[model samples]
Target chain A: MPDPILAARELTKSYGRGPDRFDALKGVSLDIQHGESVAIVGKSGSGKSTLMHLLALLDTPGTGTITVDGTEARSLSGRKLNGLRNEMFGFVFQQFFLNPAASVLENVVLPLKIAGVGARERRRRGMEVLEQLQLADKARNKASNLSGGQKQRVVIARALVNKPQVLFADEPTGNLDTATGRIVEDILFDLNQNHGITLIVVTHDHDLAERFQRRLYIRDGLLITTDEEHAA
Target chain B: MKPLEILKTAIANSFRSKLRTTLTVLAIFVGAFTLTITNGLGTGISNYIDSQLAAVGPGNAFTVTKTDASGGAASGPKKYDPSIKRVAAGGRPGSSQLALAQSDLDKIGAIPGITGVAPVIRISPDYIQWSGHDKYQLSVSALAGAQPQLASGTNLDDSSTQTQLLLPVGYIAPLGFADNNQAIGQDVTIGITDATGSMRTVAARVAGVEQDSLLSSSGIAVNKALSTALSQAQATGAPSTAVSAWTDATASFAPSSSAQVSDMKSKLSAAGYTAQTLDDRIGTVKTVINGIIGVLDAFAVIALLAAGFGIVNTLLMSVQERTREIGLMKAMGMGSGSVFALFSTEAAFIGLLGSVIGSAAAIGLGTAVSGALARGPLSDLAGLHILAFAPGPVSAVVLLVMVIAFIAGTLPAWRAARQNPIDSLRYE
Candidate 1:
C-alpha cells in the first residue's frame, strides 16, 4: 500500500508530425510502487518502451506528465532532472550498450564514473559488484571479448553500480540463449527480491510477464488490460 | 562530472581513434613548429640589431662635415678651391684631409640646437707595443665614448687622463697577451714621431679589447689624454697640414631623440654643414633584416592558421562518432555544460600535445642550426644567433595553439551538448 515510486498520468508520445505523425503512447497511465516488480507488455509499436522512457525521464510526454516520489518531474531544470535520473534509475538494454574499447570493470564503473565518484573507490565498488555477479575473473577483459550471457551480466552490473532506487530493463534477455536467458531472468528477480528495489520491465515475453505481480498490457498505444483482472 | 574527471575522460577518449588523432596532432605540430622557429629567428636578429645600435654611437649625435659650403655641385672632381681646402665647392671622397677652421667651428657651434661640436682629431702612431710585443704602425681616431664591440675587457674611459687605451682583439697576440683579460690593466707603449722627426714614446694601460667588424676593421683606441699626446706628438706638431676642413665632426644635439636628430641634421644642412647620422646608415640595414624576419613569421602564422582547420575536422569527427557515448553520459547525470567541457578539454589536450612536441623540437633543432651558422655563413656578423628560443614567445606559441584549438572545438562541442539524450541513445 506504499505510494508509487514512479507514476505516469495520461502520458502521450508521438513520432514525427503533421501527416506523418504516429502516436506511440496515447493517454497511457500507470503506477509502479516502491519495492514492487511490474511488467509493461505490448507488441511492437505498442508504446511499452515509450512509456518506460517517459517514466525514466529520458524523454518528456507530449500531452501529459510524470511524477517520481511525489515531485512533478516535468517542472525540474535539465541539470536537476539529470541528477534525479542518476540518483533514482538504472537501465539495462537488450543490445548491451557497453563501450567495446573499455574493460569489463570500466564498463561496470561507468555510471559511478559519470556520477563523479573517485577512481580508486569507483574501481573498488565496481569490482565488488562484478564479484557479486561472478564476473570478477573477467574484470580486465575488454567488453568486445565477452560472450552474449557475460555481456548481459556485465550490463546488469553497470545498471546496478549506482545503487539506484528503481531498475528498468527493456528486453534484458532478448539476445541470450534459452538457458542463459533463464539465468539472467533469475538474476533480475533475485536483485528485486534481495535488494527490495522497484523493478519496471518492458517486454513482449508472456513468460516474463507471468512472473510479475502487476502487469499493464498495452494494445494500440493504450493500456487496456490488467493481467490480474483478466485472471480473476 | 568535475572538471578534473572530465579532463581525465577527455584524455582517455581522445585515444579511441588513434590514427585519426595522431594525424590531426601532427598537422598541428607542423604549424606550432613553424611558429616557434620563426619567433626565435626574429628574437635572435633583433637582439643583434639592438646590441649593434648601442655600440654605433650616442643616439642624438651625428658626424658633421663642412662639405660644399658654397651649396653647389662641382660638375666634376673640381681642383682644390683653397677656400674649402683640397676640393672646390663640393667635397670629394678623398678630400678628408681638409680641416675645419676655428672660425668654421665657431660658426657650427653657434648653429641652432647645436649643443657642442668636437672635431674628430686623427692620430697616427708608428707602432703599439705591450710587454715588449710590438704591432705595426696604425692610425687611431679619437671619438669620445665610441666603444667598439667588446670581445673582452671593459670599455675605454673617455675622461681618463693618466693614459688608457682599448686594444683591438687582433692586437692580442701581437701585443704579447694571451687574451683580452691578460691585456687589461697591462702597460703598453706607443711609438710616435714628435714634431722634430725623432721617435718619441707614450705609455698607456690597456683598458679593454675591441672586436673587429666588417663595418670597421681592427684598430687601437685611446682615451682623451693619450689621444691628445699622440696628436701633439705629430711630426709637424700642428693640428693639420691642409688646415684640414675635417669632413667628420661629432655634433651634439639638444633633446637627444631620433626625431630631434633629424631636425638637427636639416638645420645643420641649412647652415652649410652636412650632418651624417649613423642611424641613417645602420637603420636601413636593421630594417632589411627585420623585414625578412617578418616575412618568415607570416609564413609560420599561415601554417598555424591552416592547422586550426585540422583541429576542427578532428573534433567534429570525434563528436559525430561518440554520439551514443555523449548521450549515455547525459543520461547518467552529466549536464550539457559538462559535455561541452569534455569536448573542449579534448581539443585543448590535443593542442597541448602538438605544441609541446613542436616547441621542444624547435628548441633542439634551432639551437643546432644557430651553432652551425655562428661558425659558418654568419661568421662575419659576429655574435649573431640565427635562431634563439625566448621563453616568453615559446610559451606564447603553446598558449596560442591551445586557444585556437579551443575555438575550433566550440562548434562541435556545442552540437554534442545540445543533443537530446533519447535521440542520441537511439543513434545507431
Candidate 2:
C-alpha cells in the first residue's frame, strides 16, 4: 500500500568502451519496499553486484534512473548523495574490508566518525553495537586477530552502527564455512524481521535466496524472474 | 570528517611506513640544520657590529675630507694643482691627501645641521715610555667623540684640563704595568719631533686601558687636552700658514634620523668635500660578511629543495600503498577535500618534526662552539659571539620549511583525492 522505498527504472551500466565494452547491467527494473528482505540471485557475471551497486547509489547507471525515497539519484548533488549514503545506507562485503591495524572498535566507529560524532559518543555507540553483536569483550582487539565468523559479526555491527534504513550485503558469507555462513544469514534475517530494517542481499547461493521473502533471479544482465514467498 | 579527526588519522597514517618517513625527515633535517646555523652566524656578526657601532659612539659625527678637483683615490693620476696642499694621509701609508684649510673647516661648520667641526690635528708622537721603561713607538690620535671598550677604569675626560690618554691593551704588559687596573692612573711620556726637528716630551695620565677591537686595533685614543698639548708642541717654530691646514676634519651634526644624516652628507658632497659616517667607513666589511652569509643560505635552501623532492617521493609511495584504505574512506563519505587535507597534514607534520629537531640541535651546538671560541682563539676580541639564534629567525626557518613541505605534498594529495572510489575498491 505504501510507496516502495527504492525504485529503479530500466537501469543499465557498462564497463570500458568500443569493442571491449561489456554491459554489466541491462534494462533491469526493480522496487524494494521498506523493511523487506530481498535477494538478488545470479551466477558469476550475471550483473547482480552491479544492480546492487546502482540501487545503493555507489555507482551511476549508464541509462534510466534510480530513485531513493522518491528522489532521483542523478538529481542529488554530490554532497547530498554522499550524505545520504553516510546516514541512510550501510554496506557489507564478502571480503570484510577492515583496517587490520586498527582495533575492532575503531573499524566499527568509522561511519560515526565520518559523520563527525564526538569521541565519547562514538565510543559509546560503537560499544553498544558491539555489545548487540556479542562482541563487546573483543572491542579493543585488533581486527586481524579475529576469527572469520567473529570478523563477519564485527562487520555487521559496523553496518548497524549508524542505524541505517537500508543494509546492503554483497555475498556476506562467501568467505565463511557453512556453520559460520548460517550464523551470518540468521543475523541478517533477524535485523530485517525484528528491527524492521530493509535488507538487500546479492548472492549466487540458492539456499541463501530461499530464506528471503522475495527473490529476483538475474541472468545475462537482465532480471529473468521475480518470486515471492510467504513467511514460514 | 572533522579537521581534527582528519589530522589525527593523517598522523597515524604517516608513521605506517616508518623507515620511508624517517629518511624523508632526515633529509629535511639536513636542510633545516644548515639553514639555522648560517642564519645564526649572520645574526651573530651583525649583532656584534651593531654593538660595536654603539660602543664607537659615532652616532652624530662623520669624517670630512677635501675632494680633489681633478680626480680621487680610485681614479687615475691627474694634473697637479699649485694651490692644493698635499700632506701625509691617515690610515694609508706612503700616500698623500689634499689638505683642508681653515676656510674649508669654516664652510663645513656653516652647514645648517652641522653642530660642530674639529680639525684632526696631526700629532706625530715619536715614542712613548712609562716611568723608566724602554721607549716604544706609538700611534696617538684624537678620537673626537668615539668611545672604545675599556678593559679597566674610565674613558679619557675630554673636558678635564689634565692631559689624558687610554693605553692600548697590547702595551699594558710591555709598558711595565702588572695589569690593566695597574696601568690606569699612571702618567706616560710621549716624545714628539717639533718643526725644528728637536724631540720634546709631553706627559699624559693613562685614564684607562683599551680592549682590542676589530676597528682601532693599534691606536691609543687621546683626549682634547692631550691632543691640543701635543699639537701645540709639534707646531713650534712652524709657519703660521702651515699650522692652519689639516688633512681632514671630524664634522658633528644633530641627526634626528638616518635620512637627515644622508641629507647632510649630500650637502657636504655638493660643497666639494666627501663625508663618511662611521657606518659608511665600515660598510664594505659588513657587505662582504653579508655576501658570504647569503651564499651559505643559498646552499641551505638548495638542500631543503632536495629534501622537498624526498617528501614528494615518500608521499607518492604512501598514496600508492593506501589505495584500498583511501577507497574505504571515500565510500564512507569522506570528501575529496578531506582526503587531500589528510595527506597534506601528514607532510606538514613531518616538516614540523624535522625542523624543530634541527633548529633545537643547531642552537645547542652553536652555543657550545661560541663559548669555546670566546675562551680560546677569539679571546682577544671580547664581546664577539660567532653564532647567535634569535627567536624570530628560528621560528621563520621552521615556518619556511613547513611551507616547502606543504607545497611538495600537493601533487600526491591531489592524486589521492582524484581517485574513483569504485575503481580503487575494485583494485586487486
Candidate 3:
C-alpha cells in the first residue's frame, strides 16, 4: 500500500562513448518497499552491480529516474546531495573500503564524523553499533589488523552508523574465504532481522538470491526476470 | 571536520612516512635559518652603526673650506661655489685638510643650536715613545679643542701636564687588539719642530686612555718605539718639529664661553681660514664604518634568499606524499576551503618551528662571527666588541623569517588541497 523505499525506472548507465560505449545498466526498472529484503543475481557483466550503485546513489544514472524515500534523486546537489547520501543510504562494497590506518571505531564513526555529528553522540553510537556487530572487543584495533569478516563488519558498522533507511550491499563478502563469507552473510541477515532495515543485495550466488523475499535476475545490462513483472 | 581535526590528520599522515617528512622539515629549516641569520646580521650591523653615530651626535655636520669643487686647493673663495660642498677627508684641495685654529673652534661653538666644535691642528713627523724604551715617529693628528668635558677618568685640567697633549681616543687600532685594557696613564714623549727648524722633545704622562680603543697590530711595534722616544722628549720638555710655531692670530683670545668660541671660529673662517667641527670629524668616521657594515648585511640577506628554494622543495614533497590522505579527507565531505586551511596551518607550524631553530643558530653564529671580525679589524682600532645574541635585531629577524617561511609554504599546500579527490584517491 505504501510507496517503496527505493525505485529505479528505465535506469541506464554507459561507460566511454561512440564505439566504446558499453552499457552497464539498460532500461532496468525495479522497486523495493520499506523493510524489504531483496536480491539481484546475475553472472559477470550483468547490470546487477550498476543497478546497486544507482540504488545506493553512489553513481548517477545516465538515463533514468530514481527516487529514495519519496525524494527525487536527480534534484539534489552539493550539501543537499551529500546529506542525502549520508542520511538515506548505507553501503557495503566488495573490497571492504575501510580506512586502514584508522581504528575500528574511527572507521565505524567516519560517516557520522563527515556529517558533523557531535563527538559524544558519534562515539556512543559507534560503540553501540560495534557492540551490535559483536566487534566491541576489536573497536580499538586498526582496521588493517582486523580479520576479513571483522573488517567487513566494520564497513557495515560504518554504513549503518547514521542509521540510514536503505542498506546496499554490492558483493559484500566477495573478497572473503567461504567460511568468512558465510559469517558476513549471517551478520548482514542479522542486521536485517534485528533492525528491520531494508536490504538490497547484489550477488551471483543462487542461494543468496533465493534467501531474499524478492529477486531480480539481470543479464548483459538487461532485466531478464523478476518475481513481479511490469504489465507492459 | 574542524580545522584542528584536519591538521591532526595531516600531521599523522606526514608522520607515517617519517623520512619524507623529516627531509621536508629539514629543507624548510635550512631556508628559514639562512633568512634569519642573514637579515639579523644586516639589521644588527645597521643598528650598530646608527647607535655608534648617535653617540657622537648628528652625522650631517661638515666643514666648508677654500678649495675648488674639483678638490684642488682653491687659492681663495671664488664665484659660483656650491655653498654646501663636502670636505673630503685628508689633504684633498677643497677638503677640510686645512687646519682649524682656536679662533675657528670658538666661532663655531658660538652658533646658537650648533652643538660643539674642536680645533683640529695637524702636525707630523713628531716622535713618540713609551717610557723611553720604544721609539717611533708619530703624526700629531690634532690638538682637538675641548668641548663640555665628558665624564672621563682622565684629568683634563692639568695644563702644565701637556696643553699640546694628544687625544688618546683617536689612535686607530689596526686589527687584532682584543686584550689589554690598562694602556692609560703611562708616560710618553713627543718631539715637535720649532720655527728655527730645530726639533725639541717634551716629556708627558698619559692623561687618559679612550673608551674607544684601537689595535693596529702592524703598528704595535712602531707604537712601542714611539712611546720610548716620546718619553725622552716629554722628560726634556723640548719641541720636536722645525715649523712648530702656532699659526692663528686669534689663537691668543681664550673664549670665556662656548658662544664666544663659535663667534671666534666664524670670524676666522670669514677671514679665509678653514675650520672643522667636532661633529664633522666624528660623522665622517661613523659614515665610513657603517657603510661597510651595511654592504656586508645586504650580502648575507642575498645568500638567505637563495636558500629559500630549499623550503619550496620540501613542501612540494610533502604534498606529493599526502595525496591519498588528502583525497580521503575530501571524500569525507571537507570542502576545498577546509582542505586549503588545513595545509596552510601545517605550513605555518613548520615555518614557526624552522624560524625558532634558525634564530637560535643565528644568535650563536652571530656572536662568534662578530667577535672574530671585531678582533681582527676593529678591536684595536675602535675598541668595539660586539656580542652574538643581540636581542633587538635577532628577535625581529626571527619573526620576519618565520613569516616568510609561512608564506613560502602556502603554494605547496594550496596545490595539495586543490587535488581532485577521485584522482588523488588513486595515487600511489
Candidate 4:
C-alpha cells in the first residue's frame, strides 16, 4: 500500500513531573492509511484520547516523531503547523463545541472565516456542507435550539467545511442516544468510505470499535494489540 | 482573519454583555462631554478676543514709554528730579510718570522701522453739552488710530480738518439724542479750563456712535483735529515746552512679521524706551483665561483616565467569561495576535461610541446655551459666543478617547491571547 497518511514511531507523552508524573502514552506506535477507518479503543485514562491528540498535532509527544504526508511534524514551524491543521485536518468532539449563540450556518463557516474566505464564498460552502448533512433547513436557527443529533451533525458539517484529508472524531456520538449515536456514526463512516477521507475514531465502546475496518485496543498507556497485528 | 472581519466580530462581541459595556461607555461619555465643552469655551472666548482686537485696529502700533536710564524701573521710590516733568499716564489712572518730550518723539521717529510717533495727547474736558441740554461730565481722548466698533454712522474722520468725535453709546440718551442714529453728525460743545483757570468751549461734530467694549469704554473718541483743538485751548497761556511733554507715545512701525517687530522693539529698548504691542497689553487676560480653562481640562482628562480603569474592569470580566470561547477560537487555528486584536478593537469601538455620542451632545447643548446667553445676560457684548466648536478640536477629542480605551484594553487582551487552548477547553 502507499505510505501511511499519518505515521507515528515510539511516541510517548506524560502529565506533570517527578513523583506526581503519570505517563499518558508509553512508547505507543501506530500508522493510519489514507481512506482507512480506524478505531482507537480504550477505557477512560487508557491513553486512547492522548494518542489521537498526538496524531492530530493538537499536542506534542514527549519523545519520538510523527510524520504527516512524508513530512516530519517537528520540522514544521508553528505557523505552518497551524496552517496544516487548518487546511488538512478536521475534528468532531463529544461535547459538540457548537457556539450556541451563533446560527447553525455561522458555526459551520467558522473555519472558513478563520481561513480568510470571503463572505459570499464562506456562506456558499457553509450551506453546501449543511445541505450534505441534511441540515440545510435549520441553517439560520440558533445552535442551542437544535436537538443533540442535529447538533452533532452541525459539528460534522463544520469539520467537513475545509475539505480536510483527515477527519478525527473523539467520542463524537458519546452524548447522543443509541439510535442518534448510530445515525452520527453512519454519517462519519460514510465520509470515510465514499469521500475517501481518512477517519480515526477514539472510543471506549467495544460495539463501536467492531464496526471500523481496523481496531487498536489500548490499556494502561500501552496498545495491547491490533486486529491486523493479530491477523498477521 | 481579514481586518474587516475581525473588526465586525469585535464590534458584535462588544455588545455581548450589554449592561456592563454600557456602564463603561457612560463613564467615558462624561469625560468626553466635559472635555469638548471646556475646549469649546476656550475657543469661543479666544475667538471673540481676536475679533475685538481687530476692531481696536492696533495690530500695526504699540505703546512706548521711557524706562529709567539705569535699565530697569527702580523697585523703591526715588527723590523727584526737577528737570523731568511728570504727567498722569493715560488709560491708567492715578499713576504719574516722567513725561516724554518732543525731543523723544523726534528720536523715536528716527528709528529705522518706526513709521510715526505721536504722544498720547491727554485732554481733560470739564463737561459736554448738546443742543441746549444740561451739561454732562466728559472723558475725552484722542482716537490714536483706533477704529472703535461703530454702532451707527462711520468712524471719526481722521483726515477731516473740522473737529470730529465718536459719541459713546452711553452718552446718547444723556445728551438728549433719540438714538445712536440721531446723535450722528450733530455738534457738541466741550468745555475745558485752560492754564489761566478760565473756562472755554469748543464745538465738535459727532461722527459716529461707539459700542461699549470691554476696553476703551466710557470715553469719547476724538480725531486728531479735535484732539489738537482741545489741547491748544487747554494749554492757553502755558509754556510751549510744557505742552509738548507727554507721559507716553503711540509709535507705529512697518507692519512686518512678529520677529521683525520684536527686533524693532529691542532697538527701542537699547534707546531707553519700553515698547509693548497690543498683544502684550492683553496677554495677561489671555493667560488667566487659558489657565482657568487648562484646570478645567485637567479635570476632564482625570475623569477620562478614571473611565479608562472602568474599561479595564469591563474587558477583564469579558475575557474571564469568554475563556472557553477563546480556547475554541484558538483551537480553530486563530493566532494569538488575532485574539489580541479582537479584544483591543472591541475596546476601541466602545470608546468610539461613547466619544461620538458625548461630543455630539456637547455641540448641541453648547450651541443652545451660547444662544440663550447672547440674547439674555450677555446681550451687550455683541458677536461674543460663549461656546464655539471647531472641527479639528472635536475630532481630536474623539481620537484621544479611542487611544485611551485601546491602552486600557492591552493587559486584558494579552491575558486572553496567552491562554493555553488545552487548559482553557478543560476549564469547567
Best by lDDT: 2
Give the candidate order by descending DockQ: 2, 1, 4, 3
Q: How many steric overlaps are in each model, in order?
A: 7, 0, 61, 0
lDDT of 1 by residue, B365-402 (tens): 99999999999998978878878888999999999999
**What TM-score would each prediction reach against the true structure?**
0.78, 0.82, 0.62, 0.81
The superposed Cα distance between candidate 3 and the true structure at residue B30, in angstroms, equals 2.7
B201-268, model 4: which lDDT tens digit per residue?
A: 99999999888777665878888899999999999999887888987899998789999899989999
**Which residue window of length 10 is worst by lDDT in model 3 chain B?**
B215-224
RMSD of 2: 4.9
Q: How would the docking of model 4 be graded?
A: acceptable
CA lDDT of each prediction against the hidden true structure: 0.82, 0.89, 0.62, 0.88
Write the candidate numbers in order of decreasing lDDT. Answer: 2, 4, 1, 3
What TM-scores result for chain A when each predicted structure is judged separately against the true chain A? 0.96, 0.96, 0.93, 0.96
lDDT (tens digit, per residue) of candidate 2 on B6-83 = 889888888878899899999999999999999999999998887666556566787899986765568878766776
Clashes in model 4: which pairs? Answer: none
RMSD of each: 6.7, 4.9, 9.9, 5.0
Comparing candidate 2 with candidate 4, which one achieves the higher DockQ?
Answer: 2
Docking class of 1: medium
- Give the least accurate 10-residue stretch of model 4 chain B, judged by summed lDDT: B68-77
